[model samples]
Target chain A: MVNREFTVENDPRILFGKRLAKIRKELGWTQEGLAIESGIARSYLSGIERGKRNIALINIYKLAQTLKIPVKELVDI
Target chain B: MVNREFTVENDPRILFGKRLAKIRKELGWTQEGLAIESGIARSYLSGIERGKRNIALINIYKLAQTLKIPVKELVDI
Candidate 1:
């Protein structure tokens, strides 16, 4: 199971990253697989999953599409 | 007019803060006034406006209530 310590209450980036990682794992996909599916750079997706990057809104939309999740699910609205 | 340079595409915290600041200005409220209305600390609200803090989701709801805006408006989805 993914760590639940990082939450939207603490840091949105971490919360997003963790949720992305969880969803990726649930789909049995690697970061590279997600990157390819989302049409984003592997390095950038890696950085995003690690909470090392500020993902753009467009990319977030792409990620939501690739992950088959709603954009609201990806963001903590 | 508030600066439109800071957007959900750049930084969510800044976007939220900017929106909050805009709404506060529209309501003719100072930071301290907003703090009193929102039941949050003036310093914390100031920090939030300056993008110096990561506000909690509960507090976001409080801010939304105080600002009379939708909670979704405070966050980028």
Candidate 2:
């Protein structure tokens, strides 16, 4: 079987996901709301928020744009 | 074919790669040198510097750490 335990608790992707979720909540936006605004699939956003998805830079930029924040804000801890 | 034209010239990944290459050059470091400093494979760094690969967040963090900059500095334009 292929190895399945790659991601650990301190993964940066997970931290980024949590930060996205926090910002979305701060703006009173739901996952669906932010997904539509950011032009990403809601399911995909959910995975990102859960730190299970390794999102691309474009999507990260889009999220920052939708949130009206700088790209560094989303990417940096 | 598996959608051969997936990447475009204006893709964010490509832009990110260019930025990484520029910073590395500003520091007068070779790709091999940056790769060793960032704890990433030289071949992989080459792909990222060329904007052909969608690098993971962990690797981005590692690059920022190696460069002695904030994660946002590496991610933001």
Candidate 3:
């Protein structure tokens, strides 16, 4: 048995995912809506929310811009 | 020319690089010192400080941890 999926709850990626989900939900945004508005692929956005993507800085910036928040707010964790 | 390198002065990667350099320099740490301490490659760290890399979240967190600062401080730019 191989444990290829190494994501843990305390992982930064996981924490980032959870944070993103909470903020998006608070904004009443569906994953689909955010993807469309942020010009990210829906599947990619889903992956990001699931902590499966090692997202880049530019993408993070784009997401923050789309949500009208500071990059600091999105990544403060 | 294809202009493959699209980096500009105002690019987030550039801003991130400048911010990282400023913080690291203020700490009186050399790039090689920070890279070794943070477990990042010196060359890669150099690129990051030059705004040539679109750094990932985990790496950003690692750099901040090495600097004893909040992740937000490294990324608030």
Candidate 4:
């Protein structure tokens, strides 16, 4: 049986996507705004937000910088 | 002109490599120890430490877990 909690807790992509969407919404920025600020394509950001992409460390740093949050805020579940 | 400081500051790989090396040493763990604990190949860990690899989020998460540091500790410059 799959340990759902463990799965949820350990999946960085899901954690990142959820945090990214929440933070973006909290900041009232659209995907386009965030993408432009982070220097990633909007479609790519969309994929990341949906947990469909395996984000690179550089992009994670860019998003953290652009969102003005510690990268911890996004990754520490 | 190349903003050397800015380049150094924003390069996550370099920052990560330095921090990883520092933390690993602080914990008295060798690269082999860290690689085995983090489930990454020793060769790949070496590559990452040299900043020649674009580490993925999963690997960063794995390293953070094995190191007992927040993922931010790895990615934040």
Candidate 5:
């Protein structure tokens, strides 16, 4: 039997997700709304915010632009 | 007994660490050299490159300046 890893607990991806969620909430935007503004798929946005995926670099800038935040804020260094 | 987390495998902090290490190596900088140039501690520079610490935002900018790279390149996001 093989044990597979499936959780994102304490992942740095969670940091990005948390930042994304926080910015979206601050803007009074839903996941779908942010997706539309970012020109990314809603499902992908949801996955990103849930820390289910390691988002690409380009997407990070797009999301930051849509959220009206600096890229550094989202990255948190 | 408490199970303290002791690993940073797949941590996004590792991403920053890796980028820092890469940049430093490209410039042929030793950890001590980078610390001297960035005005940070050598031990701290080692720790940051090892992904053993979550660096502060200001320090990130300092490291970027020392490396002569854009902050976005270090972020990869």
Candidate 6:
């Protein structure tokens, strides 16, 4: 069943979100700070953190740049 | 100026595209092979390689999986 198959670890989106949140917190930046620096909306960033949204390649570059890391680091799970 | 600034090396999309192409060729895989393996459209993969279209997070995951690499390796440029 669909419900049975849904899991945080099994879903790549959720895994990516968790990694993003962890890295952001590790860097001591708030969601607002990241949003402002990346020029992405705070709501969208929030959604991304919560695994509710998917971001594009440009955003991957922006987030990595804002976070001062490579895109690979940002996408690494 | 924006026109002067958009060099191949300076553009993250183009850099990423070049890297993708190199990695694909290193693995002896064609664009069509990647598309069919990843369930992504061949045209879209072509666009990504040409830096004409931006792909989302899920697509990144799919591409990495199809290419048999870590997401970080796939995105690294």
Candidate topping DockQ: 3
Task: Give per-residue CA lDDT, model 2, range B1-77, as digits (tens).
Answer: 12243356556677789889988899788898899887799999998987777777778888887888888888875
- Model 5 misplaced stretches (Cα beyond 4 Å): A1-9, B1-73
lDDT of 4 by residue, A3-72 (tens): 2323665677888898899999999999999999888999999989877777987788788889898776
Quote each prediction's TM-score: 0.48, 0.78, 0.89, 0.84, 0.50, 0.89
Model 6 has an lDDT value of 0.82
Give per-residue CA lDDT, model 2, range A7-75, as digits (tens). Answer: 556577788899999988998889998899878999999999988787877788778878898889888
lDDT scores in order: 0.69, 0.80, 0.86, 0.80, 0.70, 0.82
Q: How would you encode candidate 1's per-residue C-alpha lDDT over B16-73 as one tens digit per residue?
A: 5677788789878889988998889998889888765656545765677787776555
Best candidate according to lDDT: 3
- On the 0 to 100 scale, the lDDT of residue A11 in model 3 is 66
Query: Model 2: runs farther than 4 Å from truth?
Result: A1-9, B1-10
Clashing pairs in 4: none
Prediction RMSDs, each to the true structure: 7.9, 3.8, 3.1, 4.1, 13.0, 3.3
List model 6 lDDT by residue over B1-77, tens digit each.
13343567767667778888999999999999999989889998898898766677788888888888998998886
Fnat of every candidate, listed in order: 0.11, 0.80, 0.95, 0.84, 0.09, 0.86
- Candidate 3 — which pairs collide? none
User: Candidate 5, residue B6: CA error in Å?
Assistant: 40
Q: What ranges in model 1 sit over 4 Å off?
A: A1-9, B1-77
**Counted clashes in each candidate structure:** 0, 0, 0, 0, 0, 0
- DockQ of candidate 6 relative to the true structure: 0.73
lDDT by residue (B1-77, candidate 5, tens digit) is 12132235535456568878988899898888889988899998887887666675446656777888766667762
Range of the 10 consecutive residues with the lowest summed lDDT in candidate 4 chain A:
A1-10
Off by over 4 Å in 3: A1-9, B1-9
How would you class the docking of model 3?
A: high
Q: After superposition, how far is residue B77 of candidate 1 from its true place, in Å?
A: 6.2
Distance (Å) between predicted and true CA of B72, model 3? 0.6
Which CAPRI tier for candidate 6?
Answer: medium
